[model samples]
Target: MKKAFLASMLAAACVSATYAVAQTPVNTNNGAAAQGPQLSADEYTAYQAVITATDPAAKATAAEAFLTKFPQSSVKSTVLEQLVAGYAGSNNVPKTLESADKLLQVDPNNIRALALETSLLKAQGDSATDPAAKQSAYDKAADAASRGLKATKPAAVADADWAAIQKQVTPYFYSAIGIDALTKKDSAGAIAAYTSELKAVDVAATTQPGPVLQDTYFLGQAYYTSTPPDYLNCTYFATRTAIYAPEQFKSTFQPLATYCYKKFHGAEDGYDAVKAVAKDNLFPPADFATSVKPAPTPADQATTVFEADKKEDPTLTKTNIADREFVITNGTTEQAEAEFAPIKDKEVKLTGKVVSIADTTLTLAVSDDAKQANPLVADVSVTLTEAPKVAPVVGADVTVVGSMASYTQKPMMFTMTGGTIEGKAAAKAPAKAAPARRAPARKR
Candidate 1:
């Protein structure tokens, strides 16, 4: 992909870098391209030699000699453009970049030079060890690409030719912009720029193992990491990239797709259908977002439980400790108040893992969800009547009897007073584990 793109860039630079060289009456009284001032006879001969060189290396030398000898000539910018193209064609990396930089000094909005600068600088930024240098490279690349996008077509270039050049370089412009946004943690900006880049290229180009395909995965990551996250979009693009990736790379991309799918749909049972659909399309199909069944949000879960309750037998019962906690913690102001009304000041006995313990008060994780967090969270706090001879172990499950008191919803904790600890739940002996349950049970 690298060879092909740079080759295309060299080809474009060679053909499209031409200016009004050897025109009948070339003038540059202002040290820029103009048509009024006639070229001196000797100056015309020097310019002719530069254009007539055969080898790229020889061409570069001749162009440099012409520019140095005639620095104030009207054709300075024109000769620098040729020098940049010649170095690019010679496959000289440092020289190519140097000449392109010189060309930009003369024509700041030169599209060919900007495209080369953006691509090369971005490559350096990707592998840089110094954070400050890395950031500066991407910043400059993004700035150059931005200017390229707004560059005007010179009149000497025909409309048809300029359109073709625009098509060739526009993808780099958007890609450079996307990389800059991603480096700064601007996921929304990255998503917008990358989406435009994918649309600007041929659809087939996105399926190949190349910059476009890699950027497709980056787009999915941007969506997956965005605020509040668009899991469905993350699943779509990630699945698409996985379909085209080689076997060694397939595992890397497939896992991210599965993770996002399980996060949104709550299981992997229907994921094969998502993969099948993704294999045929670059972007998600029109109805793909709606077709995938989404798991309930926290608010939705709370609202559903509240709506389904009846006065005759409420879901917020002393026996239904986990359900009561779930609804109260996740529900809205009115819903939480309703859930808490019946349970407040009520003495309830429940078994939970001791998360933290103290002489006066300690916390416990009553619900399974809280217990499952990497570092367990306390959903229920108990104020003990007195500390025990031996303090309760941090991770041991025990039965606690306490009168429920105040609660906080956002952090989701329930405090109880005048509490006593029953003995710890028995620790399970090591044994052969049972068959693993499926995705929703995992909840991640």
Candidate 2:
């Protein structure tokens, strides 16, 4: 993201003022009277021009000279604003922020000044590599945003102006807070920030549904992706979504669940499923919960997913490579083929569901234990030469024709050169269209 550039507010403001040093008022008095010379309109204009110059060093020198020459000029506010902009553009954030603070003392409701101040403080907070520094920066950014909002007259302004402020202030504030919480692993805090964003989205959705959806989608997706180990402190966000936007969740939260199941499973899947169901109406099909098993230990993860030797059962004999089940490891089928090449002519029994069948890759979920232990177990996604004639649903039992090799970085996924189905049966009964959920009525 591009850091905000200096806007033209200052340029517009500066055009109205001009002064010259030669116009300064000199006082020749007795030793008893030693007051400084008064800077007239021309002198003040000269001072302002130099301070507002584009050259960094010259601008700094001019700023100091202006304060010294006209310590109390009405042009001080404009001068300070310019100095802040010049210093900021020169990469002197501290000086820029300091000038902004001074400018704010004169014009507390100055939006441009407040913007520069907030951006500077946020940059500082973000740059602090240490925890304490980062937290402080996040807090300061939040405070600055709040102050800006209060100073702003949202009701008095036109809708477009009000919306501009909301876009600039609300989301950035929430994002700063949410990202800070994420860094600390404070799931609850992250949820709180995202919830604020959601509320803003809901309000904005009344007038602008598309933009609201786009923004809210990002916020919701962020919440879905932040699956902390054990779900440490995210129960509130899940519960709140259920209570507040059950309808919205019902429509939009399932895709997030699917993503979670694909990215992380096992204990993680439980949290993912709970959040999904709470916000939305969908549940993981019972069979899906039984598939993608997770291992209790690292060693179990290594051995359980890839068993070495096995004889095909006559009762459970599969038709071809595509009919048997298999999961993709980090490695490729060509490597697996080479490893299992000697046994290429040999037949092996594999059972799994076609997790996905795309034009290029075919992923399958194989082991029942893996499916159950980790509902989001990694599946075998192989490059296919041609699109498969069959399409696989999320939860379906199928058989495939393929051979396994010693697992590489990629799992030893079976490449479905071709195959036929051979499964006991699907655990799911069926899917039927259902009515939308509604909240109960309240008593008078």
Candidate 3:
């Protein structure tokens, strides 16, 4: 998962350090020459041997020998730095980390050492088996990144070279910190770090999209997981991730964007427009705003149902069972009683999908006046005249005939007695009211 992140850091470290070395002229201040204490002829010769070694393995061996022979040498930090670079060049992880630690011991603010240590620690954290060990490694990596962020350019490095190094290292530093915050469930901290990381790099121009896209996905998750979730922003960032993600990751992130957009807007109707906007912008436009379509009130829905029924059947009155159920569930008591009067004991037939079956009761989600994707609204609960030998399947369409019994508002459940399946007349017995049970909560 973190291969891209580690690869980018290794490439950047090699390129930045080598570029700086090639561009800068050799001098006493920047070279391997001893600084504070004047070196003896033998000590200077040893230092020269390490610096002039033709290969990384040879340089590492010579540097290690120099460090062991002259522990108090003025050029100890320089030798350790060479050892770090040499171990890194040879792809010797343990040796590189050991060398980097030794370099930091002598020069605590060495930018290259800090960056290397932080990147290595993050990789270790990602692969750690024990949770405690993982957290510890991530914490140390985050600490190193924090210190590296405040470190000034090394005195030996030219301004241009230092700027280039900053461009290469800054994003990875923030990425480590951001991933650490995420591991700790600090969403706000993750958001801040990832935001800074994205700002530090040209995300659109990045040759390695895996890490950047992964971070964008994590950023969206941070917004979603924050208290009082910022769903609008979540939608934007999640959608942005989908836009840039590889084929395999698109399916994972795209739905998150759609889900958040639908949740914030109360429906999926206008999500395409949001997805379109995300394709062209990393963040929402400055003038961006979503017109939230508030869910219709129960009373408003009842009124709409009443008007539509009247339009379909001009002679039909609110006393009709369906209309009565709507008004009784959504209207004031006086209006409810008035509409429920004629339908109380009258037998009526209903067609709907069997949403649930509990004992003798079958809950049917009726089509008319029922909101799409919401089963709780406009559901009819029918108490069977007899418990059928074979129960109806939950999602199958069914027709039931029953006498209207009672109703409940808010959640809008209808109770019916003397209920019988259309073709199961042989199962009929006697009418009896059943106790109402709450429907199981829907899965998100």
State each model's CA lDDT, in order: 0.76, 0.47, 0.72
lDDT of 1: 0.76
Per-residue lDDT over 1-444 for candidate 3, one digit per residue giving the tens place of the 0 to 100 score: 455455545544553355222211223343466435467767877888888886888989999999899899877877888788778777787898888888788889888788887887877787777899989988988999998999997776789988987887787789889889988889999999988888898857432355666777788888888887777888888988887777776787788887777666656777777777777776568766644443355566666655565565554443345465666666677666665655678787877667788778888876345524554343788999888788877666677999988876657777899999886422233232232111111112
The per-prediction tally of clashing pairs is 0, 43, 0
Order of candidates by TM-score, top first?
A: 1, 3, 2
Model 1 TM-score, all chains together: 0.81
State the RMSD for candidate 1.
Answer: 5.3
Model 2 residue 258 CA deviation in Å: 6.6
lDDT of 2 by residue, 175-260 (tens): 44555565566666766775575555444342222322332433444555465432211232333233344364434534444444
Candidate 1 vs candidate 2: the TM-score winner is: 1
Best by lDDT: 1
Task: Please identify model 2 stretches exceeding 4 Å from their true place.
Answer: 1-39, 47-52, 153-166, 180-189, 195-259, 262-444
Instruction: For residues 324-440, write the lDDT of model 1, one tens digit per residue.
Output: 666677778888887787878988776777789877687988777777786889999999999877777778777888998988987889889999877654364123222211112
> What TM-scores do the predictions have?
0.81, 0.38, 0.66
Best by TM-score: 1
